[model samples]
Target: MDVPVLETERLIMRSFRAEDFGPMSAFFADERSFYYGGPLSAGDAWRRLAAYAGHWVLNGYGEWALEEKESGAFVGFCGPWKPGDMPEPEIAWALLPEHYGKGFAFEAARRALRHVYETLNWPTVMSLIEPGNAASIRLAERLGATAERKMEIYGREAVVYRHLPPDLLKEQFA
Candidate 1:
């Protein structure tokens, strides 16, 4: 299935394309972008983007390149994917440092979560965040995700946040 393009007030979340490589490479090359995810060389970032795009063809869902609607600029990425060893599907996102503190991450993430739950019909979605990435952890909490456990991913310790079925969470939290 083609990943659908989603729009928010200030952003457009759409599939990756070759034209996105330059801005994506710049974002990936930034140390701030790698603060929690780890540094990646330009080549590595390009390869990853290629793989991510291919995943859309293979899995029916993949990361959407987040862009500013007005400026038509690539800002970052957000969507769903299953990591190589992850036991459950995950909703993940990252923003270029310039876009931080502007609520872009949260806005895009909310749209992705809605797609996962309402459109994709996923019963649960989880975020595996680096323990030190307080910003992401807090964002997950604000989305009604609960910290489920601590686990290791890509050799780094991470806190797993889970958003269970909305009805189930309402029944339990209510």
Candidate 2:
């Protein structure tokens, strides 16, 4: 499946491109980005971008580069992905530190969730967030996700949050 461009009120979520390298590198260089994605050097960021592009070919769906609509600036990335060790589908997002607290992450994430549920027709999606990542936890909660489990991932203790399909949520939580 060809990756499609997604839009939100003030952002565009699109596939990765070579030009995104610089901004992507800058985002990764920030300590906050590593808070969840793990630390990456500039070279690693380029390699990661290449891998992200390949994910589209290998899995048919992958992360989308988040860009600001007004400034046309690359903010970060948000989309669907199945990390190497993850057993189930997951939704992920990260934004430049400057964009934090601006609702960009939530807006981009909401669009990604809609695509996963409505377009991809996924029955359920999960987010594995570090216990100390309060901002991410709040965003997941706002999206109707509930704490499902707490487990170790890549040597870190993480909390798994699940967003059930609308019907299932009603049936199970009603």
Candidate 3:
């Protein structure tokens, strides 16, 4: 299954490329990566990237490498994610510190949600956010998601934010 390229006003959501490793690894190395289970070595980052690519092959739908349209820079990734271990499909995203507060994440995520509902035909999706990660919580709320419950995932507690269903999403955003 080929990773479909998705475009937004400021981003190109596509498959992970080798060049994305540098920026990805840098993000993982920084303290900002705490919420992402990062502060990992470059090798770990490479493995993560490989997983992102392989996910498309296995799941037919997975995270996309987010690229800035104008600069063509690797910004981050956002899209549908459901590894075998996960409880359910999720809309996931992670961006570099430089791209934070720029509405890039919001733009990419809204597009991803549309893909999930309109393209993938999923009834609903959830964003698993770490507790106290105010930014993610705010973004989820901004996208009209509501907190559903708390659960332990990957050995950490996470607050699950359920996004609006297809009909509701269309009504709200239309």
Candidate 4:
């Protein structure tokens, strides 16, 4: 599947490339990656990155590499990501710890959610956030998602934040 490029005022969401592996390796090894299921070794990082790349082929849409347009750096990934083990399609993202607190996650996610609802026309999308992850919980809330319930994913309990359909969001986004 051909991944479409998405542009925001401050970011360019695009496909993963070969060079992304190095930074991903570093990202996975960092302690900040805990909430993102990291602290993984280089090999595990490869599998994770490879999974993102392959998801496009299998599902037609998957996670995207978030690039800072001004600095041209790979900040993280944000978009449709469903590994088939989850309860539903998820709109998820993760940024390097240094890039946190700047609203980039929300900015990139708004665009992704718009595409999911407006373009793909999916009924609903969920963000599976770790319960202790206050930052992500806040981001989900800012995106108009409400806490639905608790569930297990990857052996850990997570908060399933449910996002309303795009029509309710259209006015605010417009």
Backbone clash numbers for all candidates listed: 0, 0, 0, 0
Q: CA shift at 165, candidate 4, in angstroms? A: 1.3
The digit string of per-residue lDDT tens for model 4 on 1-174 reads 899999999999999998999889999999989998989999999999999999999999998999999999989999998888877899999998779888899999999999998889998999999989999999999988999999988989898999878788787677
Error of 2 at 2 (Å): 3.0
Runs in model 1 lying further than 4 Å from the true structure:
168-174
TM-score (C-alpha, index-matched) for candidate 2? 0.91
- Candidate 3 clashes: the total is 0
- Candidates' TM-scores? 0.90, 0.91, 0.98, 0.97
Residue-wise lDDT of candidate 3 within 59-123, one digit each (tens)?
89999999999999998889989989999999998899998999998999999999998999998
- Writing each residue's lDDT as its tens digit, candidate 2 over 1-174 gives 567998999999998889999988887787877555656899998888898888888888888999899999988888888856788878988888888888998888888887887778888889888989998999889778899999998888888899767576455434
Q: Which candidate is the best by TM-score?
A: 3
Judge candidate 4 at residue 12 and give its lDDT: 94
State candidate 1's TM-score.
0.90
Question: All candidates' lDDT scores?
Answer: 0.82, 0.84, 0.92, 0.92
Clashing pairs in 1: none
Tens digit of per-residue lDDT, candidate 1, span 1-174: 677889999999998989888877887777776643546788988898897798788888888999899999888888898856777888888888887888888888888887887778888889888877888988888778899999987778888899767576455435
